[model samples]
Target chain A: MTGGAVADNPGRLYVNDKKAPESLRDLRKIEEALQGNLGRAREATVGIELGEGGAGSGVIVSEDGLVLTAAHVSGGVGDDLVIITADGERHDAISLGLVASTDAAMVRIKEGGPFPFVEIDADDTARLGDWVFSLGHSGGYDDARGVVVRLGRIVRVADVTIQSDCKLIGGDSGGPLFDMNGRLIGIHSRVGASLEQNMHVPIREFHRNWDKMLASEFIGEGPFAKKPEPAKAYLGVAAEAREEGGVEVTRVLEDTAAAEAGLETGDVILEIDGEEIEDMENFLEVLKGMEPGDKIELTVLRDGEDKTIEVELGER
Target chain B: MEKTRQSKSSWASARGLLTAAALGAMASVSPAQQLEGPYRLNGSAVLQAFEPLREVLQSSSAVLLDDWKSFAYGLVVSPDGYVLTKASELADRDEMAISIGASKFTDVEVLATDVEWDVALLKVDAENLTPVVWKDGEEVTIGSWVVSNGSTSRSRRRARVGIISANAREIKGSSNVVLGIVLKTEKDQIVVEDVKEDTGAAEAGLQSGDVIVEAEGKKMEKREDLLDLLGDKEPGDILKVRVDRDGEEMDFEVELMERHRVFDGPQSRNDAMSGRFSGRRENFPRVIQHDIMLSERSVGGPLLDLEGRCVGMNIARANRSETFAIPAAEVQAVLERLLEDSR
Candidate 1:
C-alpha cells in the first residue's frame, strides 16, 4: 500500500483539538508529543499484508520493533505477507502462535530496529468519557502515517470495554489507546456498527500478561502497580484470568481457517471474541463452543515482539 | 498438436480478434456455436445444496480479498450437495462474501478444495433444478466439431468452438485419462507438431500444445489466439487441430476428449491410508502424521474415483494444499454393520 500521512478530522479522533479546554493545554502537549513521537513512530508501527487476506493494522509496542495487534487480523493466515513501516519502509514479518479463543497474535520483523516507540502508562486511571486517542496505519507505505483519537466513554463498567461514540476502522485495529494524559490506555480492538461503536483492550491487560508477552523480544518497561479483577465468562464467551504472561506463537496450521485468516507461524494470541484468554485450558474450553468456519479476531505479538495485529476471522 | 504452428506465428491476429470482442460481441458464425437461440442467464448461483452443505458453506463463506474483474468457472455436483470448483478461485477468502465482478456480490461457501487438481466445492444459499448434465465417460471420436461455454467476466457466459484431438492417454499422475484439444483456421494456425509424455494431441500422433501460426484461414500474424479458438469446443466433438509442438508447426485431424472428474472429496497424500488407523498407546510412543496438502473446504464432503464412485470424505488440508480424504467405501462398511444390528 502507498504509505503517507492522512490529515486529522473531528470525526476520526476522540479528543478534538477544538474541544480541548484551555486549562488542558498541558494534556494537549501530550498530544503534540504524540504527533511528534508518531512521526517517528513509523519505525514502531508496521503495516501488515496477507495475500488474499486483507491487510491488517499493527503497532510497535516495543522498541525492538515488537508490534502488537488483535490476533484475528493476523492469526491462521495462509496468504503471502509483506510488512511495511512508517516513512514508507517495507519489511517482512511472520506470525508466531494463535490462542483460538482470544483473537490475538505475535508477529516478528526480520531485520532493522530502533523504531519510534509509545510507552504504556501502567498507572493511569482510564475514567468514563475520558478523551482517548488512537494512531493507525493503512495501505501505501505513506498511508500508515496518521493517527485517530476518539473520546472513549466508559460505557460498560462490567467485564467488557464497551465504549459509546468511540470510532475505529478497518485500518485502526491493534493500534494504541491513549489517555488524556497521553498515557497508553489500551490497544485498539475492533469496530462495530457506525463510527460511534468500537472496542479496545485495556493497555493494562498487557501488564496482566506481561510475562508471556515479554517471553520473546519484549523487555518490560511498564511499572504496572495494579492487578485486574479475576477472570470469568462474559456473554457466553469465556473470559479467563488476565494472562500471567502472554504466549508467543509457536505454530499455526497452514491453510486451515486460522492460516486462511492470514495467521503466520509466530503470531501471539491476545484476545478472543471480546474475551481475554490466558492459558491453554481457558483457550481450549473457549474453542469448544465454536464450530469450524467460525470467524473471530485475535491480537498477537509479532517479531521484534511488541507489535500487535488484528486479523479477520476465517476457518479454525 | 497442430495449432502451435498457427499461433506461434499468428500472435497479431488473435489480439486483433480479442480487441474486437472486447469492444463488443465476440462473434456469431463461430463454428463452435451449438446452442439454439439466445439463452437468458440470470444472477449467479451460490446457494442450493444439502442442509449440511449449506451449514458449512454459510459458516465458511468468505469474500475474495480483492475483487476480480472477470468471471470465473463455478460448477455444482453435490458431494451430497457440496459443489466443486477450482481451488485457485477460493485460495484467499477475505470474509464470508465474494466480491461481485461487474458490480455484483456472490456469497460463497467454500466447503472443500484441492491445490493439485485445483478443484473445490462451495455451497450457495439458493435452490434447485437446471444443473448442468454430465456425459458419463462418453467415448469421443477423432475429428469432430465441438462447442465450449465460458465467461471472461462475472455474470456473462460465452461460447466458442474447436476440435477433439486425442483421447485416453497416460499423463503420469494416477487416476484419469487426460485428453487434448486443438484448433486451426484458414490463414492463421498455431501449435507444436509433436512430443512425448504429456497428454493432448501429441499421443494421438499429433504434436499439439504448441502455438498456432494460422487460423480461420486468416492471415497468419503470430501465435496466441489459437487456444481461444480451440477452447470453443466440447468433448466427443472434433475439428481441425493446427498445433505447434517443439517449435514445429503441423495440422492434425485431431479428436477432442471430454473432461470427466473422479468425484473426489478432500484427499491428502494419504490416499493409501484411508481409514482411521490407531495403534495401542503402549505399543507406540506417539502417532506419526504425514502432513500433506489438503483444503479446509474438504470437510464433510465425499471423495470420488475416475469411475465416479465415491471414495471418501475430505477431512483436512495439510502442508499447503495437500488433502486427506477418508474413504467412503470404509464408511459404507460401518453403516452396513450398524444397519444389520438394527435389523
Candidate 2:
C-alpha cells in the first residue's frame, strides 16, 4: 500500500452476463471488503514462528488467543516457529493440538492480545458462482507473507472437500475461503498440479470434528489406527503428495511387502488397500487407518515404467 | 621480522579494544533512541561517503567512459593520486582523468585495477597525501553507530546505527561482487550493503559475513571512532582497520576508493534528472593503526564539503530500505611504511 492508501484500482468483477450499475457497484464493494479481510488475515502469518511446523497456514478463531491453523504446522512437533507482520515485527508461538481428519489445529499464544477471527456459516449452503476469495500465503518459504487472493466460483461441495476455480499454491493450504458477506464457507487447501485447480475442506468437516476433538486428549487420531482392508489389494508403501505435481513415493519402509512387489520413486500409486485412489487425499486417509503386519499388493507407475509389489507393513 | 611481528601484535590488541568499546557504547543506547535521529542518517552522509569513489569510478578503461568526471561514485586509491571505483560506474566512459583537490589540472593517469570487483586504481600528481585509517578486524558491525558524511549546509554529518542483519547476499543489477560487513541502525538501511572484493577488505582476510563491533577503541555504541579518525586525511588515500570475525579480532588494510559521476555524455543529458538522485558526496571506510576510519573526499582530494564533511565517496546500498559502507584497509599500504616509522 502506498502510505496506507489503497490502490484506486479496486472493485473488479468476474461475472458472466451484463449487469446493472447497482450490481456492478456491489461487486466492487465485495472486492474491497475481501481485500480488507485479507489484510487483516495476513497479520497471523507475519507474527507466526518459523520452523515451528513443517508447513501450514492458519487464522485466529477465539478471543483467548486460540487460533485455527493447519495441523501439519503443529504436527511437525520439534521446529522453532515465529510469525512476522507485513512491516516485519515477529512473535513466537506454540502449537496446542490438532484434528487431522479435517486438517485443523488449535493454537494459543503465551500472552494475550487482540486477534482477527472469521465467522463460519452454520447451514453450509453457499451457491455456486458466488463471490469467494482465498486469503493465503504465497512466494518463497511462504512465511511472513500476505494473502494472495484468487477469486472464483464454487463447483462441488462434498462431505470433506469443496472444489473451486480459484488458483492456489503450496502456501495456500490450511488457509480460509470466505463469502463476500464475511462468512467462512471453507478453507483454502490444495490445488491441482496441472490446472488452475484448487480444493479445500468445507467448514462443516471442521465443525463435525469439533466434538471428537473436545472428547479426545488431542484432536486427530493416533498413528496408523488400522491398515484399511482394501489396502491389501495394492502394495503397502508410504507416500506423500506434492503441490505442483503427482504423488511421490517418499518411503518404501520395507519392501518385504512391496519388494516381494517392487516400487520406487516417481512411481505413482493408483490404489491402496484396493480403495482406488483419485489423488493425494484418498491415499493420505488410507494410511491414517492402516494396521501393522498388513500385507498389501502394490501397483506403481515408476518413471515412464509401471510395476507392482506386495509387502507387509512394519512398525514406524 | 621481530619488528613486523610486534607491530602486528600491537595492532591486534588495539583492534580488540576498539571492538569491545563499540559494543559497550551500542548496548547503552535506548531502543526508543534508535527509532529516531542520530540513529537515522541525515541524507548528506549518503553523498559525502561517495566523494572519493567518484574519481576512480569515472576512470576504468576496461569499460567505455565518456567524460569520466560526469559519472558518480569513484574513490581515491593513492595519494600520488590514483582513483578506484566500480567498473559499472564507468561502463559507458572509455577515457577519464583524475582531478586532484578539484584543481583545474585534470589529467591524472589510470593505473592497475581489479576488474572483477569494479575496483580500478588510478594515480594523480599530489604530495604528502592523507588517508583513512583502519585496524585489523576493525569492522562497523551490524549495530554500530555511524555518520554518513554528506555535503550539506548547517549539518555536515548524518549518523545512523543499525545491526548487521544479514551478510553474504549478492548485489542486484551488477556482476560486481561485494564482500564486506554491513551496518544496521534504522528502517531505511537498504540503500547499500557491501565492501568490494580483493580491495582493502578482502585482502586483509575479512570475509563478507564478519560482523564489526568496534573501530579504534572507540565503542561502536558511541559515535566517536569514525569522527575522530577523519580529522586526518587528504583525498586520494587508503584506511587501515581491525575487524571482528566470529568473535575473534583480526587486522585488515582497506584502500579508500572513490565515488563516480553517472552521466557524462550526450545520452546522459536525456536522463540527467535521474542522476541528481545519487547526490554529491559519500563515505568509504578504511582501517587505521588499530581503528577503522570512514572518509569521503571529492575528486580524491582532502577538501571538505560545505557541511565540513569529506565528499565523493561511494557507500554500497542494498535495498529500498538499507545501505552499508566499505572501510579503507588496503589503500593505506603506501602509508604502512610511514606508520611503521611513526610507531
By lDDT, the best candidate is 2
How far in Å is the alpha carbon of B304 misplaced in model 2? 50
Candidate 1 DockQ vs. native: 0.00
All DockQ scores: 0.00, 0.01
Total clashing pairs in model 2? 174
Chain A TM-score of model 1 comes to: 0.52
Residue-level error in angstroms, candidate 2, position B221: 27
Q: State model 1's lDDT.
A: 0.37
Give the distance in Å from residue A66's predicted Cα in candidate 1 to where it truly belongs: 1.1
TM-score of chain A of 2: 0.54
lDDT for model 2 comes to: 0.39
Per-residue alpha-carbon lDDT of model 2 for A204-260, expressed as tens digits?
A: 766775532321114344320111123222333434444433456654434445444
CAPRI class of candidate 1: incorrect
Judge candidate 2 at residue B338 and give its lDDT.
31
